[model samples]
Target: MIQLKAGQNIPLTGDVVRFGAKAEAALDVCALVVAENLTVFSSEDVVFYNQFATAGVVLAADEVTITLAEVRADAKAVLLVVSADPIAFPGGAGLGPVTATLSEGDTVTAEFAATPTAGETALICLEVYRRGAGWKLRAVGQGYVGGLAVLLAAHGVDVDDEPAQSDPPPRPAARSGQGVPAMTGPVSGEASTVAGAPLEVGHGVERLWMVFEDAARSAAALVSAREYAAERLDHELSLAVSDPATRNTPAAEEARRVAQQRNDELIATAEHRHQQDTEQLMRELADADQALPPALASWDSPAWDKPAVSSDGIRLGELYAIDRGPLRIPYCVPVPLNRPLWIDTESTRAVAPVVGALLARLLAAAPQRQALVDIIDLTGAFSGFTGLLAPVLNGPLITDHADISARLQAMVDAAELAELAHTSGAFPAPTEHRVLLAADFPHGYQTADAQRIGALIMRGDVIGLSTVIVGTNESDSADTTVATLSQSCRHLPTDGGTTLFDPWTGSAWQLDLDLLPQEPERQARFMRTR
Candidate 1:
């Protein structure tokens, strides 16, 4: 073991190294980066997700955090080699032991193992990524592109050079004495582009780079996986390795051998993480096994239990349907507000005759019927439905007439429950019948034509309908008749500016008299008439 102080950033030379407790500047042993919010972790080695802790650190270094969830280095010397930096090389290929949520200059210093004297700059291309599982590594390339795409797409990064297709900096050669090769003296395409201009980098060039990345990853993975499979297949187990007493006996030797084998296996697993890609290895292992795990097998297999789709009924949400309830309900005639219907007070009274027909309808909210029927009275031109009130945009905006009508109907239906509370002749129990007041409703919700309202009044349930009157000065014969009817019935103003006059007992006062408060003008007229 390399002898350094209790807390240091120096690289340990030997593979066999250990850390003590938190007090001794030793953190817990774990492969994943952990912090409160992101305890499990999204990406490891270098912390991501604006949370989670990085591995291998001194107490003071680890303790210093900017956010509640992450740690930061105080000294600028320690740094992470991210994908964006110009100085990336043998370093930034993967996450380092330390990470920060937002980008910052490195605070602490780091000492990497001595660089090998070998080949061209060591490459660290995008590998496998996390989609289904947490972060999983892709096997070195020349393999499955679709699988890799699935993994990396979520991170907003992809294994393919597709990302590089946008602008990327010139490739930095493995750090030489000449400060990370600058693109210019190096005349790099990514470095020399004019602002906002098309990035001078070409796809042909990126494809060439992919060729290298794909081959290298694939080759490295193949070698590592084959070796691991061979070693694991041999199958050995042991307990002790170096005890003298054990060395003497075959059983002892076997135990020592097994111990050595396990150690080798552990090393192999670690190597699989660093050298070959973990994803490729797992895929290879599964391939060797030939069948999926029971869970995945059942999952991937076709499901016959789900019901089949049908094209039979009215389409809703989508273009498909399945048999729902036992009631074989026939379609209702839809009064789609395809065109503009006048919506003034007068138009209201004119249409009242039609609405009167609906009075007998088994309004689900009938007990609260007065409120529902009156809600129509409550309606003033809502600005939200203004453009929508037009034939084109009408009923499609925030306050669709559909909703308006439905709410009015709902209020009436809800009143039904209240009506159940009282059996007074004033509020009759709605019968099982549904009423249609479309008589003379001319094509759509058009202006309240005298002929139209007249026809609906004669044929429809006049008592139940609502008659809307426009123009404060004078109303039509219908309005005059309704206003006169108000003499006998109970009239209550809905929350909206209008009031309802219901017909009741006496023909002399056919409209309910409760609405006396509703009309100051009529109250004045009564004095004049008297």
Candidate 2:
């Protein structure tokens, strides 16, 4: 129940065709092709230097597969592809050279390649008959479209990539001594393309007598060799067709399965490496201890640049114009605890609420309590109490006295207590670093605003309680201010100087900068202004 078709002649441009209700049948090897017969080459029009008349046919489409790229390379050759239909791929998926569902007529100049990514391979070719959706295939003929590509890969072509000379390199004439050859000057290191897709090449010659002579000689040479080759090819194909023992050989099946296993391993390795790289990038950003210098506002500029905080609020750096175009768009909701940010020190972009809770519980329970209490200015000392916290340390957990984590623990323990008794007058309160910072700085703030707030903290007279002044501003008229406290006030050397002046306590204050290494930048920045 099959109809004969006078299909359109396939040109050198290549072509396509749709099979109508083809009986799902296996093909016998010895049959000659007719107008009723349909066949597909494993690689169509494969020109192998006058070696054979044409390439071998697969006869069925769904038995094989091809890997493809989303965007085909505009390489030096003709890259031909065929597909059945338009297919959407996830994450901009890349498809290989295989054809999808072919339309009624089989010639297509527009290849329907649904590739996932750029510069990567996709499966483009396939065996025609398969086990799934009943979509017809579009036959692919690569050589017909773009033809051959000749590259001088063996020579020192790569050296051409270096800096070009003032005078162009000498080129061998395509035809020497009174000749009109097709080629011109020397090859620029760049690939000299022969116009179309990536495909096989043909050396051109124009003479009927010579062409016939060459063809005859080639055919004669092939005929001379056919007796030996045909015997081997026939024997191989016969073993595949006739002897069940040979046809069902375990070696071939094992080889295929082993190849499949190796391919799977390779793909898995690639994917794992990609994931690891991404995780490493995230870790670098999350664990930046002493990375780029914190952006400092010089006194001479007299204008505000928001203090550069990392993706989180830890050590502030310089505010560069990095977050441009898209990053400028606001993310989700505003964080409520903007002021006490200096204490949290967790990255702003990380999953924070859980860490915040863990810190709170740890601060309340760790046995080293006294050192934690002294760091905060509950008695009205330092100026940045209302500032937020960002994570400065996420080192390994160690219990010994000399361990870095333990050392950090001591400093943090002291910092936490100071946070509790100082600015808010909420003494003896549960010490969650995040909660304490929130109480001190109860709102969202931009980086410059945080710096301004830091400056205001210096104005604390009553300090930590009352008007809650942060910097040296004297004009704030708070009725129940947090900045007016007198007990915790003290002054030390103005950064690099030996002068001691207490703007808040108004007395001779003695302090050693070497003991508070954490505030060195803060000291230098503010001292320079004075």
Candidate 3:
């Protein structure tokens, strides 16, 4: 049998060959048929112990055998990799010191031990390939620190969609003098017992200790030598210093001065290197933080109110804003039932369709025929919501200036009556609510109508009478608060300044809104059933 060390190879003369191994943990054997260009055709071409459907490879416990019959003619070589895990190779955990190519018919056997400092987990254990009409076995002990997945990805296998797997942290760098003893001289040289044989005289050790003067002087020299060696070679060097009398000579004193100067230079170099490393680490940490998705810093804040479903169709959308992270802050505007929802359309043409959809959704979500809707489409942009509103529209669509005035006065009168009824406690608050949707307000409203409209906005919330005013102009009254929708799907209050509300993140984000689904038939059916 030929004993194969790492990076060794031998000729193969047979049609089939068997491999065997003994390991402390379970091992997986995989084979890849590589081409001249070094690219894999597909993930399916990789054969592992668990998936052995490849034509000529047979896998079993501790060994795998490859037959020559099924290897493709265009294949350059078969690479054999051994791993400890199924999903990923153990990075830094080494493998295999094996024997192979024992005579033509003999089986190959391999044994592997874990590394003292596992520098890699997955290793290219062997390679079987054609060598001019004959086969050859090569022991390739190259290891991958990133494991099998990384190795495969490097060769163009698409593993981007694979589930995230935890990777082993990189081995920490050894600190100065770790695991190494202070050496008085060369580690391989003969041992010496002379006290002052290893240290040079009179350079940085005059007062190394506070104890006995003679012993302290000797100890200081030794300490200086060790420090000098560690700074230069990254490990303490063993050296034999001569007697004190010998070291006190002129030549020794000069050598001591030179060593001290060199040691100082090394210290400066080390400090500079350390500063660079610290800066690099800080930058990497900052990049990692930026890559992570934003999250809430605290869930207990009052601004993070929970959202509630509105029975009336005035539920515009959820609000999203950014605080410590992206947060889903509730949109607290009470519409259709309480407050007037004024949507300013100057910034966005999409406001009309969005408002239409909101109205349709509210109508569809309402219980039975308890909610009423009236449309005054001054801009004639309510066609998107017309199918859903057709079944429940309170009156013929009002378009004239006089008609809008009359509608606002009627709502005011109704609200006053409802307020009187509510105060008297004659009956429970009415379940049926009226919604006035006045599209393109102020454009078709006279001064009298505007005053009436302002009054409705002021008292509509308390009386179960609400108005949705859609217009391009800003309202003059504080009671008529306005929310403007931008073309980018940013919802901005006229008074709220630059902050834009994102409905999806429930936070203030720069993201545009996703188009609301337009299901006219479903909405129409819902309105009819209600």
Between candidates 1 and 3, the lDDT winner:
3
The candidate that achieves the highest lDDT relative to the unseen native structure: 3
lDDT tens readout by residue for model 2, 1-530: 11101110111222223221111122111111111011111222221222222222222333111111211122111212222111232332323332233222343322222322331122222112110112112222211111011110111122223221121221322212332212110122111223223311110111111111222222222222333344655554554446566546886555545555554554454334334433433343233222321211122222212332211111111111121111111001011122222222122212122223222222222222210111222212233321222231223222222332233244445445566566677655432222212111212222333333333333211122111112232122241132332112221111232222211111121222211123545433322110
Which candidate tops TM-score? 3
Model 3 spans > 4 angstroms off: 1-315, 318-337, 347-349, 461-463, 473-498, 501-508, 511-516, 522-529
Tens-digit per-residue lDDT, 1-530, candidate 3: 54443323445767877655444555666777665333455666577754774667666665566787577665546777666553333443444332222223554343322232344546566677654355667555555555666556644456665524434322222223333111111111111112222211110011111011111122222333345556664321111135566566776666666665666676555444334433443443233223211111011222113222232122243233232222222222222434355565553335755565446444433344366777887656666656556556777788676688777788788777777777798646557656777777556666667666666765665455556666654533332323111121112233223344221111122222212346665434323324
Q: Answer with 1 or 3, whichever has the higher TM-score.
A: 3
TM-score against native, each model: 0.18, 0.17, 0.35
Each model's C-alpha lDDT?
Answer: 0.25, 0.24, 0.46
| TM-score of candidate 1 on Cα atoms, chains taken together | 0.18
User: How far off is residue 37 in model 1, in Å?
Assistant: 34
Candidate 1 lDDT by residue in tens digits, 206-259: 222222222233333333444554565354332342556665788876765665
What overall lDDT, based on C-alpha atoms, would model 2 receive against the true structure?
0.24
Q: Which stretches of candidate 2 lie over 4 Å from their true place?
A: 1-248, 268-289, 292-530
What residue runs in model 1 are displaced by over 4 Å at the alpha carbon? 1-202, 210-241, 263-530
Prediction 2 TM-score vs. true: 0.17
